[model samples]
Target: MDVSLGTVFVSEIMGTAMLLLLGGGVVANVILPKTKGFNSGWIVITFGWGLGVFAGVYAAYKSGAHLNFAVTIGLLANGAAEYAPGVAVTFASTMVYLAGEMVGAFLGAILVFLAYKKHFDEDADPGTKLAVFSTGPAVRNYGWNFVTEVIGTFVLVFIIIAFGKTPSGLGPLAVALLVVGIGLSLGGPTGYAINPNRDLGPRIAHALLPIKGKGSSDWGYAWVPVLGPIVGGAIAGLVATAYVV
Candidate 1:
């Protein structure tokens, strides 16, 4: 089936929105005190991210909803998508997809924020406050933090493309399992901000959202989630291609 540009854009938006809701919502629930999901732990994050993938993919499977930058670049690198037809079309469409994802991510964060607004106000730890928006290491360090994100994202895309076979075959249940495993195994280090849209969009939302004395958003570590996933996904796709070929 031929994919339409409009469909692609809408699917990306919807999928990303769901991702943010599941992922960012979990953070809000865990970090916010006296709430139901408060301190729910890594398992919750893993499950939430897994289900987020299922929900996003389910919503946008028809329109090539990738919901992750790494997947987008990997598809282009492997000639899976016709991104070479026209420069303007390719560039504009890709940027549009990213934009849609950011919007979706923001929407998800907003939902989580609203869901736990009262809790946010009640909570008073700076670290906890930051957790509601973006990820940070259990023990802070520059090198390991980047590595964790890279490894986590690499595993995520590899499974999605190879095991899950999304947008082609397989089902959400399997896709969700792949994510669950990644979260359980690789999510410990940096909370597994595997998708750029998933991290940056919600981070942006956190900055904009009114949360009373919300501390710095950790902009310095921002690029890790953004760049790490892209590089890791590219490598995984190349490796997959070599093996398959």
Candidate 2:
């Protein structure tokens, strides 16, 4: 399972870019007017994200398919002991993973916006447009929103670690299903960001993009998605190390 840092960077960048492209693309499709999948609802969104994870993981499996920064952090924390020995989870590699994921996520959001350029112009709702790029709380309560994100991301990273014991081929599918389940069951509160890169990168893109009628990037609520998932992933990693390693 040894891979060079260069491979990790390239794979993470490519895979995470694809992940955001498809995942954000789905939100754009359902929310933006003139799109074929307009108003297709949450089920479609959950499936889209799951499929996005599937595609991203398949493309990045050579570097352990860590398209998510939270996942990479979780594995690094786990590797502190013996849970993931000889896996090259060094500080330098972690930085590379983080850098790649951030860039990829930003680029992916840009791709989605370009692909749906016509819809952005036609759509008049700023909230809906922003939704395509980032997650927002259904209730707008920061404390509760943070809790929901923590619980959702804990389930995500913990289950991913648990699934590592399964057959190699089943890993991608299993994790995808886990994402779908998280979205369906726990996503109602905060749209199930579950990964810091997935939310922040696109939110940054939303801020920078020149989409017509795009509203505030909601920078006020942005920290929850990023910090909650990292805290949750760290907790999952520590628990997994204590229990499994």
Candidate 3:
């Protein structure tokens, strides 16, 4: 069952939008003031993101659920021939997947902002407000922060590649659990912005949105999340090709 590239693009967008919507919503609920889920702690956020991945995988099933560019690049670096069954792995298709993921993430962040509009206006720390939109480190060291993201993303993409090679009938649920595990285990460092689009797109949204009292988007540290994931994912792909036999 072959499909057009355009269809693949939209599929990714829908899936990723669903992902960010729920994932970001959880953050907003837990961190933002005057919400029922306030102070719900890390477990809720982790599971929310995991469930988000589960839903997103199904939504983008047509595009092999490449909701993150890291996944797409990992496939490419692993010498993949197709993005999905019919979507050939070419430069154009790569661009399409990335574009869809970014747009979807942007849209999803907007949804989260809208959903939590009341909370955002209820007077909160600028850092907390920013956290609702994007990730920040517990510590302020860029070098270590970058390393943490790299290590976390390596585990993410590596395990993801392993998932593709193994058959468990778990499908998207497997990826969801992996995300949860990543968050529980490694998310403390940088909130595990293991996917570039997952971090950057919503970050751009934070900068543009009219959220009252929202402060700096923390653009200075943005490159860490973006580049660390890409590098980690690429390494995972290469290692998977050689080792995951």
RMSD per candidate (Å) reads 2.8, 2.2, 1.6
* lDDT tens digits, residue span 1-245, model 1: 66666667777788888877887777677667887877878788778878888888787775555778777666555545452222223666767767777778888888888887788888487668778778777777878788888788777666656753343244676777777898788877777777787888878887888887688888888888888888877777776666544
Better of 1 and 3 by lDDT: 3
Candidate 3: tens digits of C-alpha lDDT, residues 161-241: 776732112388888998899999999989998989999999999999998998999999899889888888888889989
User: In model 3, which runs have C-alpha deviations exceeding 4 angstroms?
Assistant: 165-170
Which has the greatest lDDT? 3
lDDT per residue for candidate 2 within 187-215, as digits (tens), equals 99999999999999999999999999988
Candidate 3 global CA lDDT score: 0.88
Q: Number of clashing residue pairs in every model?
A: 0, 0, 0
Which pairs clash inside model 3? none
Model 2 spans with C-alpha error above 4 angstroms? 80-87, 165-170
Q: For each candidate, what is the lDDT?
A: 0.73, 0.84, 0.88
Model 2 accuracy (lDDT, Cα): 0.84
lDDT of 1: 0.73
Model 3 / residue 159 / CA error / Å = 1.6
Ranking by lDDT: 3, 2, 1
Superior by TM-score: candidate 2 or candidate 3: 3
